[model samples]
Target: MPEEFGPVGRGEAIQALSREVLIRRSLDISPSGFITIISIIQGVALGLLAQNTFPKPTVLGGIQSVTLLLVFVSVFYYYLTMSVLLRWAPSFLDCFLPFVIASLEIPPAFFLGNAVAWNAWLAGFWFLTMGGLMITTKWSPVSHFGNVRKAHRLLHDLLRELRYTAGIGGFMVAFCALCAHLIPWQRQGWGIVGAGTVLAMVAMIVARTELRASQIHALYGVNRPPFN
Candidate 1:
């Protein structure tokens, strides 16, 4: 390796790695956790509203179901990708996740949602590009620069939010596309009502998180900032 990429002493390397592990552990979240649960609630509530207020599906229901199943799989692929990234976990491919996601998810995204699919695709594209740069340039996937644990932390934080952004955005748009056909265009104004309801749900989720954080702070005298 070039001097620029030479290994730090073992002691320093160990300390850096230990710090990275601590941050990743602190930032870890499960797919069934609060943020994902709330997003699921948001998607479901909107889907229900559109269903009750619009034309019932007859034949298209099956097709929509299949299409949506695929879409869900796409989002789940993101979920899996993020789960690994959250811990700065390395793949044998050295970060081929986004490439895999882009290949498998983008097709369904294009079929399920135009703008939403692009949102999904863009997430994969970014990871693949950034990951490629990190790898080829000989940066540790977890630490790109020396003596900068903060950079490692930043990567964890960025991937966490990016996962949520891409996954939730894609799911929300997919929900609409799947159900929009149920309501005739003339009556589809109710879809807005569903959207509004989802917005309200998100607001309530945020409020609840803040409330819980405040309660924790009061009880334990620790700073508890609200987060997704």
Candidate 2:
């Protein structure tokens, strides 16, 4: 096959994208540690913010606010994972992330609700994101100028869409979660949970993403570097 030529981003995820357009990719999993730390900080901040913002919130509201925020931030990172590498069959696990990501405020919809539990889950989930980063870094070099392959093309398209859409969507969703602290939007916690579930279902049904990802992995061998 004839080779295509252009600059691709200098990372594992978006390396297949042309330099003609600006893009970014996950270079490594080292950022995992940073993500964990930041996630905890964000969770704490959210907790404090909720506590200070609304005096009438349930006793658990402060805690749930923080916990749910942690999950939301971590999920952003989860989707962020897809930007770099496609998981072959993590679909089943991915399906359950919504539950893992949050619990409840008034009734307390989750079990094992504790700071330790939240932090542990946050770290664990972030690890998955980091795993994706590591995998993508391994095969990043496979796609490059004058050496673009079919797998690279597919990856390029998928990754760009993943990053842009997920990045934007994550912020919006997080904002929605934050809104719960302010307005009485039908018990904001439930709204966040519902929105998360809807997004997850939509991703599964509309994207039908896992099969395509698995196929790309089988054909391209992204986990193995240089792809050739």
Clash numbers, per candidate: 0, 1
Instruction: Write the residue-wise lDDT of candidate 1 on 149-224 in tens digits.
Output: 5545544444444434434544554455445545446223433432333343334434443444344344435555
lDDT of every model, 2 decimals: 0.41, 0.42
Q: Name the lDDT of candidate 2.
A: 0.42
Best by TM-score: 2
lDDT of 1: 0.41
How many pairs in model 2 have backbone atoms within 3 A of each other, for residues 3 or more apart or on separate chains, i.e. clashes? 1
Runs in model 1 lying further than 4 Å from the true structure: 1-98, 104-142, 184-228
> In model 1, which range of ten residues has the least summed lDDT?
108-117
Q: After the best TM-score superposition of candidate 2, give how far the Cα of residue 152 lies from its true spot, in angstroms.
A: 1.0
**Sequence-dependent TM-score of model 2:** 0.34
